[model samples]
Target chain A: MRSVVIAFIAGTLFGLGLTISRMIDPAKVLGFLDVAGEWDASLALVMVAALVVMSLAYRLAAGRSAPFFAEKFQVPTRRDITSRLVGGAALFGIGWGLVGLCPGPAISGLGLGLPQLAQFVLAMLAGMAIHRFWFLRKGSH
Target chain B: MHNFTPYSALIGGALIGLAAALMLLLSGRIAGVSGIVGSLLRPAWGDWGWRLAFVAGLVVAPLLVQWATDKPVSINIDSNLAVLVSAGLLVGFGTSLGSGCTSGHGVCGISRLSPRSILATVVFMAAGAATVYVMRHVVG
Candidate 1:
């Protein structure tokens, strides 16, 4: 119960961060991507700022033995490269370029209640379902 | 370059970082949206509350922010429904295949200095860059 609450709070904070940063604006994002034309560095700055904070937090947290909430950290074990990985990256790239909205920004855009967001979210969910049932399952066998 | 005020971005990033840290401290879980959302679909024992709350918070927090700030948020989509759907499917498929989304791996995982996350971030970012290049340059 508590953990769910914690997760919800975290996600809310994240969404707020995206909104405040103006990351939800696809034009701003596309501007950042327009290196050859305008070379908007705002998004880069945002990324760097995020990295700096994350670095400090990790340094402090690592000194401790375990996380404050659960028993221990939940890290994945797989390290090898695979097709799903490459394919996923390619697909993600296409999506980001086409719409200028990734998962985080897309969710944030939902605040506007735009029909496009609904379409994106639904398709995203369906894609996840397909991968979970078909690809991951088949790959494990 | 235009005159840049990084105050908002910095403050926002810090809040997100703090939120991620607090979530870890309080709940021993990484602030990964994909994992959280996935867990909601086929919830395990006693996992419904937090997932619902987390998603609920996502929806409500912005409303609160807007109410307080009165900043109008406008959403514009250049593509059609088909494009949006295909794009969403691709990202969803990628998230499952890669084992996480940008937030899960890119933000939280990278914060932990995980090697897998570093690699995943690289691949995903590169993929995004290339896709953007192709879409805007070649296809368009």
Candidate 2:
């Protein structure tokens, strides 16, 4: 119960951060990507600030043997750079460039009452479902 | 530089970090939005509640901000339905295959100094930049 509450609060904060930063705006994101033409590196500054704080926070979190409400910290252990990793990232990048709406901003935009964003999200859901179906059929993780 | 927002960007980023930190400290989670959504797509018995709550929180954020500041969050996107649909599909497929997105790989994974995350971020960022250049420059 408490875990759920905490998750909700965390999510709210994350969404708020994205909103206040104007990252939910595709034009802002596109500007950041426009390195050769009127580039805006402000978002990079955001990422840098986030990285610094998260690194410190991670150090503190690691010191604790267990979480406050959970028994263990769930961390990804895989370190290999598989083909899927690179290829999929490339695909994701293309998609991000095409629409300038990564998952975080897109999901955050759900309540923003935008028809274009709504269409993107619905298509995203469809893509997720299709990917899952294809993965199950292949059974080759 | 007209749209530059360094102060808000940094402050909002800090808050995001704080949120990620809070989630990790309190619940032992990475606050990976994509992973969270993926879990909800095929939910486990003990997992659905928190996952749903988190998504609900995400969905409610704009409303909260509007109520608090009396401002509508602006969203700029490609208006072409074909582009939007294709972009959404690719994002879904790619994030799933890569196993993370900006939140997971960009924030949490990179902060941990994981090699995979580093490479993935570099690849994606470069690819995104290249795609933008091609679309706006080479073809334009």
Candidate 3:
């Protein structure tokens, strides 16, 4: 129960961060990506600030044995690049470029209830389901 | 070169960092959205609370910000349904294949200096940049 509350608070903070950082705006994202043409460095600054905070947090957390709410850190063991990775990256790139919105911003953008974002989120979930059941299944067998 | 204070960006980044750290400290979780959502799909005992709360918080936080700041965002994606759907599927596929998303690997994992996450983040960012180039310049 407490963990859930904490998760909600954490998620809220994250979403708020995205909103305030102007990351939810596709134009800003595109501007940041337009390095050769215009070179909007706002997003870079955001990234740098994010990295600094994350570094400090990591430094503090590294000393701890266990998390406050959960049991252990849920890190993945697999490290090699596979077909799923290559294919997924292609898809993510296409989606992000077309819309200038990735999962984090897409999910956070839900607050605005735009139809396009809704479509993106739904399609994203459907894709996830299809990959988990169809593609991964075939690969494993 | 530009005179940008980065006040909002800094505060926001700090909040996110603090949240990620707190989640680790309290829940021992990595604050990965894909993992949290994936866990919800195949939920085990005592897993529902954090995932649900995390998702809920994501939904509500913006509303609070909008209310407070009066600077609600408006998104304009000029793509057809087919394009949007394909893109979503791709991200979904990518998240699963990579074992995490930007939040999981790019932000949190890289913070911990995990090698796998570093590779994954590089691939993800490169893929995104390449896609944007192809779509905007080449295809158009």
Candidate 4:
């Protein structure tokens, strides 16, 4: 219950931030990505600001034994550099560069009632299903 | 220097960081959108509630902002149907295979100084830039 509320609040804040920063705008994202033509450095500032605050927050979290609602910190523990990580990230980046919408903006944009966003999201889910069926079903990372 | 919005970008970024921090401190979780949404595809027992709540919050945020500010949320998508569909498929598959996306690896993982995340971030950024270069400069 408390965890759910916390999750909701966090998610809301994230969405609001994305909107306010104009990160929700695919054109804006593409502008930042367009290094060769009319580059917009605003998104770089977004990354810097987010990193500054998150780094400090992580430092604080480092001192805590457990979170308020959960008994343990749930975080990724993998360390090895695998082909899967590299290849997957590359593919994801290609997709992102192709259409300036990643999961966060794509999911948030659902509220706008846009048919295009719906189409993108449905296809994304299908892609996820494909991954689950092919890669996950094999039981190998 | 096109459409540069420094103030809003900074403020908005801080807000995102704050949300991520609160998520970790309050619930012991990473506010990685991909991980949150991806796990939902499998829907394990006793774990789908908060995930749904989080997604619902994301889905409702733009509406809430519009209602509060009396201004429609700003957004733009230039890609046609084919591009959108293919891109969506790639994103879904890649994020699942990679185990994180921007929020996960770019922000949270990097902040934690995780080597794996740093590498993933670098790889994705490079790939994204290269793709953009090809499409905008060469192909388009």
How high is the TM-score of chain A in each model?
0.87, 0.96, 0.86, 0.96
Residue A108 miss distance in model 3 (angstroms): 1.4
Which of 2 and 3 is ahead in TM-score?
2
CAPRI quality level assigned to candidate 4 from its DockQ score? high
> How do all the candidates rank in terms of lDDT, highest first?
4, 2, 3, 1
Q: lDDT tens string, model 1, A58-101?
A: 77766777777677865455667676666666676666667777
* Count of steric clashes across candidates, in order: 5, 0, 5, 0
For each candidate, the DockQ is 0.60, 0.80, 0.60, 0.85
Candidate 3 residue B40 C-alpha distance from true site, Å: 2.5
TM-score of chain B of 1: 0.91
Clashing pairs in 4: none
| Prediction 2 global C-alpha lDDT | 0.85
Each model's lDDT comes to 0.71, 0.85, 0.72, 0.89
Docking class of 2: medium
Write the residue-wise lDDT of candidate 2 on A1-141 in tens digits: 998899889889888888888887888988998888888887897788788888998898879998889999988889888999998889889888887888888888888778888888888777777778888899966
Show the lowest summed lDDT stretch of 10 residues, model 2 chain B: B70-79
- Highest TM-score, which number? 4
Q: Which ten residues in a row have the lowest lDDT in candidate 2 chain A?
A: A122-131
Write the residue-wise lDDT of candidate 1 on B1-140 in tens digits.
57243777676667667666766667666666777776665638587777667667666666777888887765557888888888888887777777777677777877767777778778876766666677777777
Error of 3 at A105 (Å): 1.3
Candidate 4: where are CA atoms >4 Å away? none
The digit string of per-residue lDDT tens for model 3 on B3-113 reads 243787677667777777778777777788777776665538667877888888877877887888787665667788888788887777668666777678777877777
